[model samples]
Target: MSKPLRVVVWSTGWIGSIAVEAVHRRPDMELVGVWVHSAEKVGHDVGEIVGIGTVGVVATSDADALIALRPDCVVYAASGPERDTAAVPDYVRLLEAGINVVTTTSTRLVYPPTFTAQWRDALETAAKAGGTSLYASGIFPGFGSDQLALVLSTQSSTIQKIEATEVSLNDHYPVADVMMDGMGFGRPLDFAPWLSRPGTIEASWAGPIHLVAEGLGAVVEEVRGSLERALADRDIEVAFGMIPAGTVGAVCTRAVGVVDGREAIVIKHIIRMARDVAPDWLGSECDATYRVDIDGDPDIHCTMTMGEMQGHAAGRGAMVATAMRVLNAVPYVVDAPAGLLSSLDLPLTLPRFALRTAHR
Candidate 1:
């Protein structure tokens, strides 16, 4: 059999920890090392940190130590509010060191298109110099944005419009905190706040929309956002804590892509807990839906609903998928342009032996 892909996973937070477990389960990928932010976890076994059975690998806070291992790839799943700020530095470092990288950072979606010219130039230079590749993709703005739209394009003889939606009922604090505090989930609905905010929900998904639009040979003329909130009637005790009832703690965000003042693509994101009142218009509980409408000789409407089960599955699944996809591209990154790269540009086919090894 061919040698296993030596992978070093950075971080052991929620998604990061899960990704480590997923990598351990794969047959063709060997967990060689781990990078952690805490000194306490530095000497601890990776399996212990991630709550899996013992695997000799230990976690270290030093990036240089992990890099010295010369891993074929690094699966970056570090925990933080801003992926660009928290993860990009490490990503650039790894790329410059000639290690292939795959990350769940939000900024990864716009690498080739919307990224800052400096960052873009740096990444490309690093990759070319190091002969390594870097790529990013995930569930929300990643697959939901690019992959789904790409899939829909296959069905359309001529494409006209695309709309995607993600709604979830979550009560966990850190997760909910990102939605409520970071996303302004319970705040007053206003376009001014979104327009002024640089990385808010509206602007965050713009990269994905632009990526897909560009892939489909369409140009986005205009993008607009709308936010809606649902107030609870009474306090509800959830896994996180007691969220006072009647508090406006849920939000629905919509972004419409217009071509010549006509709606061509609309993206909607909804974050809510089970206790929140369901909207009469949307006709569903806390669930994600992706709908595509194509105007052609025969009109086409395609919808995909990810309910409680699928929604819950998304967090960990997307993380694992992103890591595996990235690990599979280490060879290309080692040989291609550096800086930042998108999953759309990577080879989708993974080594069959790697899949078998991962499963084993």
Candidate 2:
């Protein structure tokens, strides 16, 4: 048998660490190195940084040193307050070196089209010039927004409209600060701010909506957003931290891309904490639900509901699933088109064990 693919894991954050675990368990992949942003973590064993046993790999922040290793691929899971500025450059550098790349950045949804147009073009050019490939995808807008929408289209003949909805209890927050502050949890919030804001949650999903609309052979003229918040008066305990009960901590946002004032594609996101007691539209026990509505010949509708108890598991599953997808595509990306490619454009096939293992 041929030697396993050598992969460099850049970043040890939440998703990065999980991707490390996923890579280690795969028989076809080998972990060769790790990259981190913290100086304190430098020189430490990669296994310890990921909470696994020693694997002989040491963590370093030196990009030049990492590039010198000549890894076959780079799984980038770096998180930061400044992701667009700092993290993106790292991935681009790797791509420029002709190394395959897969990332979980939310901004990745707009590749080659909306956001990072120049960078996307550059990466595509580099990948093509170096015979490498690069792809980006995640669970929310990545899977549910793009892939699932594409799947729903298969059920339609003359598709007219498509709608995707996601609802979750706030318990899915991985980091307390981001959940409580970045999301404005535990505060008397106004939904208007997020809807009217240029770069808020509503705006973030626009990329996926546009992607789906274009894929469905429709041109979206305008987009509209609506949001609701759940408030409590007391505090509730959660794995991340305590969120004030009865405070405006949970938010439900719905954005619709319109063609002639009719909804073509709808993206819905609901995030809530333990204090949220509001009844779900479908009445599932504090779980997350994804529903796709397709108006076509047969009127296709597909729904997936994940139990609330599996929120953490699902988040981890998303990380693993996305990583495995990237890992599986590395070989083909070497000869793919010369431009930013989304999950839709890349040649991706789910690994058989990925779903079974992630569900566990």
Candidate 3:
């Protein structure tokens, strides 16, 4: 076999930890180094950072030193409030240094065509200069909805509408900023949150919608976004913290792409802290659910429910799966043409390894 691909895992957060584990397990991959932003994790072994036994690799805060090692690829998963401002330059710098990058940092990067010209051009130019490539993927915008929807459409004869729905309970999601400030989860009903901003949903979900449109040989003429919030009747507790009565308990949002004045492609999100919090809004029967409906000649409907995996919770299962999606694409991204790539440009990226272990 060829030499294992040298890889550096950037950051060791919830998602980053999983990426680290993935690199260590894959026989075709080698963990060369690790970069961490938090001062506390700076000197620990990478294995200790991810709860595995010692692998003899130490974590470092010196990004320059890490990059100087010249790993074949970097799995970028650092995330925070400044992610938007920071990740772009990270991508450009790595690509320009002749290192391929696969990340789950920015959702919009899943399909680079929908990004602003300035951002797209910079990355493309960097990739061209260094002869490298960049790919971003995850469950929702990556495979669970956008790519899966398009793949299923091939079985249709006359497609009329395509709807991808994600119905999940965020009680155990464990992101306080996302639930409180970003989503207004515990805020009053009258308080407008990030998801309710005009055109925000449309812009966020446009990547997947346009991908579906492109896959179906059509163009999106317009995009529309809307959202509704539900107030809690009583105090409730979630992974983040306590949500008091009369605060926002659930949210239902949609991004609809119009084709010839019709809602041709739609992406809907139904998130609730508790099922009773928003019985009136759209919902699902399970803790985590993803459904794709295609209104075509045969009217295809595919539903995927996320449950426990290897004795992990549904939310944990989802996070690991998302990281695996990006890790599995590392080889394809390295071999792909030197530029920004999407799931459409690559073949199916399955899990690198599997055991006979069962979840009971």
User: Candidate 2, which segments miss by more than 4 Å at Cα?
Assistant: 1-3, 118-131, 172-177, 190-196, 280-287, 306-315, 352-360
Global fold similarity of model 3 (TM-score): 0.95
Better candidate by TM-score, 1 or 2: 2
- Indicate the worst ten consecutive residues by lDDT in candidate 1: 187-196
Model 2 earns a TM-score of: 0.85
lDDT (10s digit) by residue, model 1, range 248-360: 55667787777657777777766665533556435333245445555653576666555454336333433455454544555555445555677566555354444253344
Q: Candidate 2's residue-wise lDDT over 26-104, tens digit each?
A: 7667888888989999999988888988878899988898898888888877776676677666767887786777777
Error of 2 at 322 (Å): 4.1
Cand. 1 TM to true fold: 0.84
TM-score of each: 0.84, 0.85, 0.95
Q: Stretches of candidate 1 above 4 Å error?
A: 107-111, 173-177, 186-199, 281-297, 305-339, 349-360
Question: Cα deviation of 122 in candidate 2 (Å)?
Answer: 4.8
Comparison by TM-score, 1 against 3, better one = 3
- lDDT-wise, the better of 1 and 3 is 3
Ranking by TM-score: 3, 2, 1
User: In candidate 3, what are the lDDT values of residues 105-132, reduced to their tens digit?
Assistant: 8888887899767988999999999999
